[model samples]
Target: MAFALRSLLLLCGISGLLTGVWSDLKVVRVPSCPKGWSRLDDRCFLVVDKLQTFADAESSCQGLGANLASIRSAVEDEVVSALIARFASTGYVWIGYNDINVEGTFEWTDGSPSVFEDFDGAPPTNPGEDCVQTYPETLSTWDDVDCDTPSPFVCAKDLH
Candidate 1:
């Protein structure tokens, strides 16, 4: 019957599509981070040796096709802190979050919403402290500091 034949052809086509999809998924590989960068989760991060103001640090990261590292989770915070410990000279490290545009409303440079925060002691209440940085005492915790303060910063690139 023609109807039976069409059904059989449809089933075969669906099976072929499934097989192709499975093969593609099986062959898909996560590319490694570039040399001198550390991989964590689905991103690559690097601690710049040079110290720069928060704005300059952001510019430097942009130059490398990355943005100042944004900590989205506790695991990411730990990883970035470890990277800073390994390569940073100064105690504090500039991150991507800032309340510059709106006081008390911190946002990442990449325009992502801030859902995770690990503040040290107390969050910045000082009017001049707008840029976020890792606390020296607790590397995982963050604090808002003056944006002009020069410090080494971490950069993050997404792994596509």
Candidate 2:
């Protein structure tokens, strides 16, 4: 009888935990993004209107402890595109993707995996045009341009 009673109490305790009837736990707040930056998921994004070469733009982002924005999924692509449309000047904006190391093999400046591509038409057919940009007017589709070309850019950093 005692064993059965203990089992019943244990079951009730576990049931209370699963049902969230115990209110001893404290709530943890999510970290906030920097001022003027937009928060999405676990990242913070900022579109800079200043025109700079791809390398220079990346350097500027590094100064802020961020990397050039890397779009890893279609959802991220849309969010970044919206950020550009809202905050950046009307033109192509530099992204972190580039084939600067080897033609036809694109990689993100932040060393993220090249998992998604949103090209406007063709997928980077122009050799020596290594840097990647998104044309906000064309559904925010991507294009490869000369790395030396000056353009606005997006920067991304972790919320932490």
Candidate 3:
């Protein structure tokens, strides 16, 4: 009985050691958003109140290792719009959706597929209005405006 007890103790010790080593080898990393940015699942978003043209807004976002926000779903649209309303107040803010390269074929500046669109009422038929902007007060709705129009903007980046 004493020998069996000793064997059981030794087995438990070995099992504990293996578990510790395995846990040490499998270090898990936690994702986080940068300061002042909000996290929605795997992505982080930042709203800049400074007015800038579409190109300049994209440039600013790129400088921060991000891009102008490409809202892909209604949930994302709602969250982004809420962020704009909270941080940028009631106004239009530049998003990444645009049709500068091909009219009527709007694409995101970050190269994300334009999977979702929440245009406010009728879509723009103006030839010169290539960029897109979202008014927080209008909820998840968007509108097309000239790329040169100055507006506050949102930036988004994936968490590493």
Candidate 4:
């Protein structure tokens, strides 16, 4: 009898947890993009009015109170793609991931590479290509490109 009671209690607890999670997810709406920016996963990225080099893009993100944004989930990636499509910039957008630490080894400026791994679907394996960017030319997710090539970047920060 005791074992059966425990099992029933466990089931109820699990059900409650699932219910709460569902409610939370439902309440979570996509964040709004700021003017001249795109919104994804509650974060906004700048839409360059004029084409700028990668460095310039990074600077722009900084100007907006965030660093170069990185997409770490399918949801965020989709948002980025949607924004990119809408804006239709010529090329890739700079993300926080890069191989600046070691050749062919990508890491985020945030210090933890794994934190940004979700956004990094397939990383670079080539020796020369170190930095990461979602190349506009291909829809294969992320592509390793030369760091100095210069492209637009995404920036992220705390909601509060």
Rank the models by TM-score, top first. 3, 2, 1, 4
Worst 10 residues of 2 by lDDT: 119-128
Candidate 2 residue 59 C-alpha distance from true site, Å: 0.4
The numbered model that scores best in TM-score is 3
Candidate 3 lDDT over 47-128, as tens digits, reads 9999899999999999999999999888999999888879995479999998888888889988998778998665666799
lDDT of 2 by residue, 10-110 (tens): 99999988779557667899799999989899999999999999999999999999999999889888999898888887668999999998898889999
lDDT of each: 0.88, 0.90, 0.90, 0.64
Worst 10 residues of 1 by lDDT: 134-143
Residue-by-residue lDDT tens digits, candidate 1, 22-124: 8887555769888999999789999997989999999999998899988888888888888888888876799999999988888999776688889865566
Could you tell me how far off, in angstroms, the CA of residue 86 lies in candidate 3 after the best superposition?
0.5
The weakest ten consecutive residues by lDDT in model 3 span 117-126
Poorly placed runs, candidate 4 (over 4 Å): 1-33, 111-122
- Model 2 bad stretches (over 4 Å): 1-27
lDDT of 3: 0.90
- Model 1 residue 130 CA deviation in Å: 0.6
Candidate 3: the clashing residue pairs are none
> Number of clashes in every candidate structure?
0, 0, 0, 8
